[model samples]
Target: MTGRPNDWLLRQLPYGMLSEDFFVRFVSIFQEQAGTLLQHADNLPYLADVDVTPPAMVRHMGEWLGMPGIDTSYPAATQRRILRTAAQTLQWRGTVRGLTHLLELYSGGPVHVTESGGVYREGAAPDDPAWAVLEVDSTGPLSESDFLALVLDEVPAHVQVEVRVAGRTVWPVLAEEGEMAS
Candidate 1:
């Protein structure tokens, strides 16, 4: 299925079959439908591609990826950008790197994720709960509150995080009906 079609009819057809008029006509009709189906099959991967997928289908892809903060209000371009990094986001869901990657896709700028309680050692005493510092430029497509919500979703619930946007520290926001993030 991954390789080229190498059936005998396609690879080494007999000359006698080519000369039969009825055979040729019947096969031509069959080939027309088969070719169309084959072409669709060949392009099936493009449907999954965030860059080339149709705008209407991109939202469905978001659902398949289980990417949070997706909404119909966000522009198709923003949705694509978020979907493009869904794999990386899912892969690093709970760590600093995962949160950083997802925000970077939205901000298109440098995102800093620094945490203070991750050093491990043998027989070392367990430290108090960890805290994370998330810093990003707020001049991106995402509004500040929406951006913060995404950060909360990616971060572990037990870990306390402080977000600073454009150099101003942001306390936790209790947004009504959590807003959408790109």
Candidate 2:
């Protein structure tokens, strides 16, 4: 006589009374359930898929992904973008590209970053002090203090940052018949 298969159903039933067909069916069902559970486990990493995942789950995954600017103050779509691009942004950390990207995100405008005091020479030391000027062309409603704070959070710790809010200036045209007024 054949031995019973190692399964919960087999353990509950008498070994001698079990039929081969019954054991095969039970094993098939167990395999199907295990496959389904494994499939669900495999989908855990894709919890950020907005179509299928809940918003709360996506936010939780964003937290796990350690995305910057993931706070509730930002829109859900913005947070999602940050989480999706977390790896790429981390690769650009401490770089002008990264700072520009961050400033644009926070200020909702174009950003220009310029650095001074790091002039390269043939025999200059690598550890030279540099200052960065961040000129933001902000069309949004962010206040000066808020804009400066946002820039400060993204700039590298070693560089001194000067935040400038730039805007278009229009001067009155001088009349053709008269001299310009001082």
Candidate 3:
């Protein structure tokens, strides 16, 4: 019969030598333990199919699935948030909102996106090149190169992207005065 190892072991036992009460008790205990194991096995597929939105499952199974936004480099809470929102953000892919969200996620700050040529003015042609400018105001610890890489990874190939860092001070215009005051 198709059954667990415990069932086969019980079948091979010398049942004739055992008292009826002893045999019944032993079989009952074996079934109880084996049934629990079988139930867990049955749930394995459901667990595997669970989405990454659950923080516990993301922490446990993320590496096996290579899930996005579950990087260990980020803080635990950030990783959980990223996993929770990954699917939602992916739905907006190729849009300005998506890029802005991605930049915010990677930089841990606010992002502003400005687009050009995508909208049709009254008489404008539809073929105009679309471009976007991303302004990031971040005081987080991400380096410039890492921030750029993260932004670039999310941007669509068809859209040109310009990145500008906010709050930087530009050099003051020179005057005939010997020194410039801040």
Best by lDDT: 1
Ranking by TM-score: 1, 3, 2
The local distance difference test score of each candidate is 0.74, 0.62, 0.63
C-alpha RMSD by candidate, in order: 6.9, 11.7, 9.1
Q: Cα lDDT of model 2 overall?
A: 0.62
TM-score on alpha carbons, each prediction: 0.63, 0.53, 0.55
Q: Could you tell me how far off, in angstroms, the CA of residue 70 lies in candidate 3 after the best superposition?
A: 3.8
Better of 1 and 3 by lDDT: 1
Off by over 4 Å in 2: 1-45, 48-53, 57-69, 117-123, 126-128, 139-146, 167-182
Provide the lDDT at 82 for model 3.
62
Q: Write the per-residue lDDT of candidate 2 for residues 1-182, one digit (tens) a residue.
A: 12424354445566565667777677668766765666677677666585456566656766665543355666677666655655457677667887777667666778887886444788774665777877777724456656565566666777866667774311122457854522
Cα error of candidate 1 at position 78, Å: 3.1
Span of ten consecutive residues with least summed lDDT in model 1: 4-13
What TM-score does structure 2 among the candidates reach?
Answer: 0.53
Q: Highest TM-score, which number?
A: 1
